[model samples]
Target: MKIALVGIGKIAVDQHIPAINDSPDWELAATVSRHGSVDGVDAFTDLGDMLDARPDIRVVSLCLPPVPRFAYAMQALAAGRHVMLEKPPGATLAECHALTAKAQADGLSLYATWHSRQADMVAAAKEWLTDKRLTRLHVTWKEDVRRWHPGQDWIWEPGGLGVFDPGINALSIVTDILPHPIHVTGATLKVPENRQTPIAVNLEFHHPQGAQVTADFDWRQEGDQIWMIEAETEAGTLTLTDGGATLKINGERSGTAAPLGGEYPRLYAQMAQLIADGGIDMDLRPMTLVADAYTLGRRETVAPFHD
Candidate 1:
């Protein structure tokens, strides 16, 4: 399968490019980026130009931020190419739905990947939670934004999803491992004093099965940051740490495993299988939760943040 990559940013380099290089079924046909180039690969600064030039490109992986993903995805799907989207899909629920519709109309595959769901421990957590009755959940994702984001000013922009940058990973894992769906009951966002978007968020989730989940995400933590989820259930208290790479049950270490490799590679494999099997995989449940959180969340201004 001939594939093109859009947005040659950090993630595109750290994950997408290497994944494409390693995939046997996928060939990196072209790339569109404003300020980067890939050796031996056709490169263009404009997505439209690349699409027009490489008519044989059957797949397009959009690594751009959420701002322009919808339009690019629409164009790619309309041109009869399967599209893969990075997390958060689009800035809003309406845009995501529109892309889904466009993909269906064009008979193309749309893969909205939640990389956290592809973590090694996620499936194990799912299996462990299957028969257990969850009573409470606590999630904490605190990271040093300056160290991770650096000069990426877009992260603090209005639609850039400040704290949700890492929070969404927790949400994805929670959504995947839970036995039943959960709804946002309440949320409070802490916006930086100088920014229109939030830098931290505390959310409460309510499930029909009497589960109460609380998530706290902050972009201000320093040193050894935390990305952990703890669940209290009838069977035992389960703890997932290191962004779902390690799991423990009732204070005892349970497992330690890393994902096979890059998430994009696994995603492409899944996409290839979908195409070969004459089917599509589109799950919007997680995106819906994110949209709902944004719509229902309350906002408060906090101290100013600086890069």
Candidate 2:
């Protein structure tokens, strides 16, 4: 399938490009960005121009930030193209719903991708936990923002979602593996004094089965990064680490590591199948959890973050 990739930012360059290149079902037909482009693909600064010129490209994958994504996505759908979105879907849940409606009205496929849920071991972990009655599930996702986002100031803005940007990846995995639904009960958001978004967060959830569910997200770790989820159930303890790339059951390794390029390839494959089947996959459970945190959380101003 011919696809145009919009927003040639760090993630587009680092993950999307290689994933598209490696996939057998996709072609990087064109790009829309102000300052970034693939070496040989045709590029445009405006999405409208790309849609007009490249009608052959049936799919448009948006890698842009959440704030400006809705406009581009709507434009593409209006142009009669299938749409695929990065994590969290949109700045607001309403926008995601609007896009979904647009796609359905246009008879197009819309994929709201949660790449972390595609991690190699995530399926295995979900399968293992399918029959177990959970007693506890805790997510610890901490990373250095300077290392991952670098100079991206958009993240500190209101809709950028701060730590929840990466934290949502964990929630994606959590929502996918668990058998029952969960809702946020309480939360504490630690916002930097200089920024509008939180740099750290603690979330507590009310599990339908009365299990203890909590998540801790921070962007302050310096050394080894940690992305792990431990779930203690009636059967055994299941641990998913390395962002669902590895899984362990009761302290014993459970599966092999993911393939060379990891989650994006799988996402692209799923997108291809979705397009073929004329289906829309816009599961917003993870985003709902994040929104609930913001709505229910208590805010605290922390030390100002520089850079």
Candidate 3:
């Protein structure tokens, strides 16, 4: 199917373009971006122009930031096209719901993609934890924002999600793997003095089966980055590291390591399947956890972050 990519940012160039090009089910028909464009592809500065010009492009994949995603998604759905959204779906939960409603009303597919859940070992981890009796789960996600997102001013602004931008990836895995449901009980957010969002956060959750669940997210790490989740159950310990690309059972590696961009390929394949099945998979469990953190967290003013 022909698909038009909406944003041509770092992620679109690095992951989305490659995934679409490699997928047999999709073609890079066009792109809509203000400052970036793909080579040898029809590019437009506005989405409305792309929609009006190419009705053959039935799928519109939005790689834009969460703040502006809802409008683009609604526009695509209004044009009777299948819409695929990047992680977190939208800046607000209500907007996501409205998009879902509009998609259903229009009989078009709407996919709120969470690329992390498609990580190789995530399914393996979920399978192992399915029958086990959970005891405790801890998520430690830290990275240097300057190294990953340098000079991205929007991230420090309100609704940018700050540390939770990457932190939500861990939540996506947690919410998908665990057998029991969990919700936020308490949280501590470390907001930079000059920024609206938190640069660091410590989240606590109430597990239904009395398991101790917590997460630590910080965008101030220096050396080797960390994206690890350790889950303890009555059977044994299951650890997912390297953003769910690697799995360990009781300190020993258990699953085969997948290549770096495995997630995006699977995400595109899933989007194709969603369109084929005429379904909407707009899971908001991960986003809900982040939203609850914002609501329950006690903010602490930290030193100003420059970058």
Residue-level lDDT of model 3, residues 1-307, one tens digit each, is 9999998999998999999999999999999999999889999999999999999999999988889988899999999999999887999999999999999998999998889999889999999999999999999999999999988888888789999999999999999999888999999999999999999999999998999999999999999999999999989999999999999999999868887698999999998999899999999999999999999999999999998
Top of the candidates by lDDT: 2
Instruction: Report backbone clashes per prediction.
Output: 0, 0, 0
C-alpha lDDT of all candidate models, in order: 0.86, 0.95, 0.94
Off by over 4 Å in 3: none
* Residue 207, model 3: Cα distance from true site in angstroms: 0.4
Candidate 2 per-residue lDDT over residues 91-160, each given as its tens digit: 9999999999999988999999999998889999999999999999999999999999999999999899
**Residue 230's lDDT in candidate 1:** 95
Give the local distance difference test score of model 2. Answer: 0.95
TM value for model 3: 0.99
lDDT of 3 at 55: 95
Q: What order do you get sorting by lDDT, best first? A: 2, 3, 1
